[model samples]
Target: MPLVRVDAVAADPQQLDAIGDAVHAALVDGFGIPADDRFQVLRGAAGDRVVYDPGFRGVDRDDGAVFVQVFLRRGRTDEQKRAFYRALAKHAGLAGIEPRNLVVALTENGLADWSFGNGEAQYLDDPPS
Candidate 1:
């Protein structure tokens, strides 16, 4: 399961929702992840957080398109991340845009225990199980 957090500048609520849906589709439909697995997507405004280099001027006009950064438990290979980035770019309607223009960050973490069940039951902490 991947917990995705999307950060962008000047993106509207509808666009944010679309971005989240696109990420989920890329993970589940494209990556073969089970639908029941945990996937959380959080959207943050660009003004709320900085998304530019110190000497860089904004390339996105009013930051119209959403910029995304993904975090997941470490285990995904470099090729996998590249593929995911490509898929995300396509899903985010950024196919023609330069890859460098798109910002994608991946954070890794050691696996930990998690459960998604009623109080009366317990389940194994297998991702996509």
Candidate 2:
């Protein structure tokens, strides 16, 4: 399971929802995560509220830049991560976001780090393979 947070600069409500769906689709197709295991928080930030270097990493970004952060369990290979990035860009681009404006960060943790209500570490009891 992955928890995704998307912050788009100068995006509207419809774009935010499309971005969320795009991210979820990437998670499922690229990472092989369950399609129904989607959890996300999408927010639209004003242009002035976001800060970025237009030429950072040799990519030309603008006010339409989007920042995505994902938190999930650790186990996926480096190859998987690379594929996920590509898949995310393709999906997000289809949602009208420029591929160059997309920024994704993944944070990995262990099963013990999660608590899905009831104060229980649910995955600890029966871990994923």
Candidate 3:
């Protein structure tokens, strides 16, 4: 499973939808994630949750970029993460922003217990047993 969260300023619904669609496409198409795999997306405005660096600022007050965090059941290699970041950046329309301005983070852990198929099947171990 992969969960994606996006944080930014009060984003347009269309933009949010587009970002979700694009992220799903990148994961499924570019990363070859199985369609049956679970993927979750959350988008929210900055509000009081985000804090900017004092020395850096943007010309457009409303022009804030998205921060994407992906959580998964297993970890990816550094190369894989870089590729995913590139793909996500393209999907999120973050091309023009400086590399340092964009942010993406990933967290991974083995699933000790997860149910599927009405609890008929459970995942409870790491890989290569």
Candidate 4:
């Protein structure tokens, strides 16, 4: 299960909820993750916590930018990641958020690093349930 974190400028809770749902859908569709394997944190910042170059990467961004960071086990291919990004952009765009304002960051870690509960690194010895 990937630990997802979404950060964006302060906005209505409804909009933030939509963004979160869209991002989760992108993850499930692109990575083939289980539908219920969802863990996400949505942060609505007040000040300028998110800074980006309006023209960086040849894309323009505004203060409404939404930053998504996904922390997962390291096994996905580059193609899978690209598909995730595309799916995310498409979903977020449909919610009235500009595609250019979305930034996705992927971070990977080993299975030994996760502890679902009971202070146990459960997946370290076997495949995840």
What lDDT does each candidate get?
Answer: 0.59, 0.92, 0.60, 0.87
Error of 3 at 85 (Å): 0.9
Candidates sorted on TM-score, descending: 2, 4, 3, 1
Model 2, CA-based lDDT = 0.92
Q: Which pairs clash in model 3?
A: none
What lDDT does model 3 reach?
0.60
Model 3's C-alpha root-mean-square deviation from the true structure amounts to 4.6
Span of ten consecutive residues with least summed lDDT in model 4: 45-54
For residues 1-129, write the lDDT of model 3, one tens digit per residue: 677776654456676676666667657754567776646665657454666552355423334555667676675677777777677767556433333445567778666534445653356533332
lDDT of candidate 2 over 1-129, digit per residue (tens): 899999999889999999999999999988999989999999999644788899999999998999999999998899999999999999988999999999899999999999889989999997877
Return the top candidate by TM-score.
Answer: 2
- Model 4 TM-score is 0.92
Worst 10-residue lDDT window, candidate 3: 54-63
Q: Tell me the spans in candidate 1 whose CA falls farther than 4 Å from its real position.
A: 44-49, 54-62, 94-101, 113-129
Q: Which parts of model 3 are misplaced by more than 4 Å?
A: 36-38, 46-49, 54-62, 94-101, 113-121, 125-129
Q: What digit string (tens of lDDT, one per residue) describes model 1 on residues 29-88? A: 445567765466656575586556522454443344445655555677777777776777
For candidate 1, report its TM-score. Answer: 0.66
* Model 1 accuracy (lDDT, Cα): 0.59
Choose the strongest candidate by lDDT: 2
